[model samples]
Target chain A: MASPIQENLVSKNAEYASKFTKGDLALPPAKHYLVLTCMDARIDPAAAFGIDLGDAHVIRNAGGSARDALRSIIISQQLLGTKEIILIKHTGCGMLTFSNEDAHGLVKKNLGPSAAAEIATLDFLPIKNLDDAVKGDVEYLKRSAAVPEDVIISGWVYEVETGKVRRIV
Target chain B: MASPIQENLVSKNAEYASKFTKGDLALPPAKHYLVLTCMDARIDPAAAFGIDLGDAHVIRNAGGSARDALRSIIISQQLLGTKEIILIKHTGCGMLTFSNEDAHGLVKKNLGPSAAAEIATLDFLPIKNLDDAVKGDVEYLKRSAAVPEDVIISGWVYEVETGKVRRIV
Candidate 1:
């Protein structure tokens, strides 16, 4: 059963399509950079980060996990010619609300024992300190085998409350 | 030194923050769904998909690769409470432009031998066909033990030229 919001997506998209004009952008991003950020609904990467049409690749995940995003990051840089990266985690992220044990318990309680066992080895990538996580993700990218040494990678924290970004590294 | 556009990011972000609102939404998405789509700047997932504040988690990557997004998908559904998935790929994506070998050669040519050696085994997750790719990703998510069987996963192809999405699975 499609939800009302899902149905709205189709109709609203049609309206957007009627007025859309920036559909002829190039394959590779014009600015030749990429950003790894969270899938937080509070943030709009395009508007908040000032990324124009066909400007950059934005790889977003749960915690903005660098490890989770590395595969796409490699492809973005190697295949698409992006030379820089901006990794942005945010304040008040749900990833900060729980530990691995907490996540496991939630899975077991909500999904069942089989589902819990299925994800037993999974890392939720939870972080205790926001600043440390940002700096660590930047450092991880710097040391990554897949990321070239010359590719400039910086880290920042996007404050969902204030809609401001604070550079952490 | 930040690029000219990177500098624009700071200035633009400041402008956005000055008028920011709607930062008090709940932790869980209001609509309890997620959209796994491409990082292509041409597509604005929020506006195109009619995702309002705190509506859904939008997981984006190169080619909108579901394999790359699996970790976050698990977290979004299990840890968070999203019950549905919208897997949307687009036409004429950069992922369709190159194969793994082409990416490897570009890595070597652009970043030298050592960098090429680092990502020698990378799977760029390139798609040869758009509709088939969307179906395949939906199937992949359905087959994954991590994704619950009851979770409604649908596939669509977002046409960059026409700005319309066609259902594939």
Candidate 2:
């Protein structure tokens, strides 16, 4: 006997799986380009880059910090066979609002002191300028990770107000 | 004297930063939910979960596998002060198209024999069933690394065909 939650889950899964016929499935490209960007509503990668649905792998996080996106970067390159990486940090990011002290206080208030302490020790790469931040992130990916030397790593800044992307480095 | 690349980067950064005033900044929140999903074009968490920008930290990857997004997840939780984690894997993923053998062959052919050898050792968790996969990933997150036990971890499967999400235990 299935619980109500389990039954609901099965129904939902069945509906989602219905679109695909097993015979119609095709493998994705071996070499993929992974883009690490911010989840800001203003920065639209598809429109700016003229990217289609299946063209590039986009990994988005807060502030579009490459340090935050490093794990996915490794997996995308090593396990998923992506060669190129593009770090797209944008202007008007919410990350620039708070200091490390504010972050610690918030964690302690909501999650308790123990979790807050753990958070304090974590490294956060701050951005003074969006273009420099994007470039630095690209450099970090190239140098810190196991990405191939020939990998075309690039950095770009998406202007939130103007809806333009300028390749930084 | 700055290189051409550095000069271009500096000018672009200055141009973008000029649009923002000091008042546009928002204070950091008391708690953050770090979410990991896939780069599948069909899945949209904001519409499904009613989460706005700056509400939760979302990290996306190719398979929506936790291992692939582990680095971003760590940074979001540890550095950015997110207390809870929600790992979402969706149905009808492109990742399920290729078997491990096929992936190995493709990487070998394109990248090189050594690259293929390295990729073969990588643990790319493939899921035939979406619900089971979500639950399994949640369990994996609990066991692996420095993830907090009391972090209120949960897993959900987003059905691409129907824009609906089913919470999996």
Candidate 3:
């Protein structure tokens, strides 16, 4: 038996799925480059970078941390056939707002104490420095056995107010 | 010394970063949610799902396949403290166009035979069925030891033509 919320979601999904024919939405070859960045409201990859719809693969996350977007990067490059990767971390990012302690407290309050404690132990959370964070992420990518050595990997910081991207390392 | 291409990118990124104040960005909590979906021009998660800035993290990939977005997911949830996850695979996805053999051949011709072979072995590429793909991604989220059991995992297929999201079990 499904909850009321789940039931409602199912009905809505079915209705949405009915509107499209299989032929209309065909996938394209995995050519071009891949970009990993933040999902902040102010940053627009298309306008800022002049990226068209079919040109590159974009993966956005909080803080634009490369570590956070690594899994997607592997799949995009190893599986999807992309050769170039651009990682864009941004200024005024929501990620730089909280500390590990604050996050642990929030998680404990919203989830549970145990869950919060578990999160604090992970090496990937609560980035202390922005420049170091970007450098660390680039290093991680470079060291990853899955990522090809020839794949061009670059890092940048996007300024939300100016709509520009600045390469950091 | 940076190359001409690297120098150009750095300038663009710095231009954007200059617009933000030190206080504009908020740091994330210990636990956050990272969402991976398609960049279908039609799906507006902000309007439809009511996701606001500084809310759940969003990572947009080509087809929302776990395999393609796996590295991102791992970093977001594991390092960023995201506990809940939503994987949105949409209807009329471009991923449905090429078969495994075709994708391999294209990569071989454009990139190299070894690169193509690498692509063929990845679990996330060349989705066979949309429904199955959604189910498989959810299952991967649930079964992965890296992901917590309590993580509220859901999968949906968004219809590009109708702008509706269909929940897939």
Candidate 4:
């Protein structure tokens, strides 16, 4: 049986597909850039970031961890032609609330020891100071040999409390 | 000096944060579920799928690949408390337009031989057939022992053409 959410997705998508006309946008984003943001439900990247239909790639992950998102970032830049990156981590981020140990312990608590064992090497990428974290991610990208030095990289803190984004680096 | 995009982000975010007041919502998503979708600018996951603030975590990647999103999904389910997964891959996704070879070649062309060597092992997670890809991701999640057996996993196609989402599994 399809869940209510799934059913709603179908109907809502039907309504949306009916009027959609931009079926010809190129595979690579036209703007030649990408934004890495948290998957926070409160922030709408398209509306908030002024990204158009074929503007830029938006990569979201928990805490918007640049390290965790590096795989996708490489694909976006190296394979897809994006030349710039805007990494955004937000305030009140769940990542700000836990440490690696807390996350590992929680995994054991919620999914049992085997689950914990499975993710024994996992880096939860928790945040201590949001500003430092954002700056650090930009530095990580800059220092990364895989990421070309020519690629423009900057980091920001998107405040969930007020919806304001402040550039950190 | 901040770039124009960075300045715009700050300004636009200020406009949004001024009216934003959903700061008191619970930390753990209310419905204990998460939606994985593409970060296509055209699709608004919150408005399109009826996902209210704090309802569910939204994990997005290039193709909404379950394999790529597994880390966040684990965190959402095991650490946060989400018990269900709604994985939605969209029509006309960039993932559908390339193969691993093409991706590797693009990387070599765009970022040079060193970059190509860096990502020689990357999967790129391209999609040959969208339907099969969606179904395969659901199966991947179901078979993963790290993901609890009881977790509700389903896949769907979010048609960017008309904005309709149809369940595949």
Shift of residue A25 alpha carbon in model 4, Å? 3.3
Candidate 3 lDDT score at position B165: 71
Which digits, one per residue and each the tens of the lDDT, describe model 3 over residues B5-71? 4554566545544554433434452225656687443344543443444555667865676654544
What is the TM-score of each candidate's chain B when compared with the real chain B?
0.95, 0.75, 0.73, 0.96
Per-candidate TM vs. native? 0.93, 0.60, 0.59, 0.91
With a 3 Å backbone cut-off (N, CA, C), the pairs that clash in candidate 4 are: A13-B163, A13-B164, A14-B164, A16-B162, A16-B163, A17-B162, A17-B163, A162-B17
User: What tens-digit string does per-residue lDDT give for candidate 2 at A68-93?
Assistant: 66545655665556667767787777
- The DockQ-derived docking category for candidate 2 is incorrect
* DockQ, 0 to 1 scale, candidate 1: 0.64
Badly placed stretches (over 4 Å) of model 3 are A1-31, A99-102, A113-121, B1-35, B38-57, B61-87, B91-129, B132-155, B159-169
Of 1 and 2, the candidate ranking higher by TM-score: 1
DockQ of prediction 4: 0.55
Report DockQ per prediction, comma-separated: 0.64, 0.15, 0.19, 0.55
- Sorted by DockQ (best first), the order is 1, 4, 3, 2
- The whole-model C-alpha lDDT of candidate 1 against the native structure comes to 0.84
Residue-level lDDT of model 2, residues B55-156, one tens digit each, is 566677667877656545655665556677767787777666655566556556655776655545754455566777788788988875456676677787
Q: After superposition, how far is residue A55 of candidate 2 from its true place, in Å?
A: 1.5
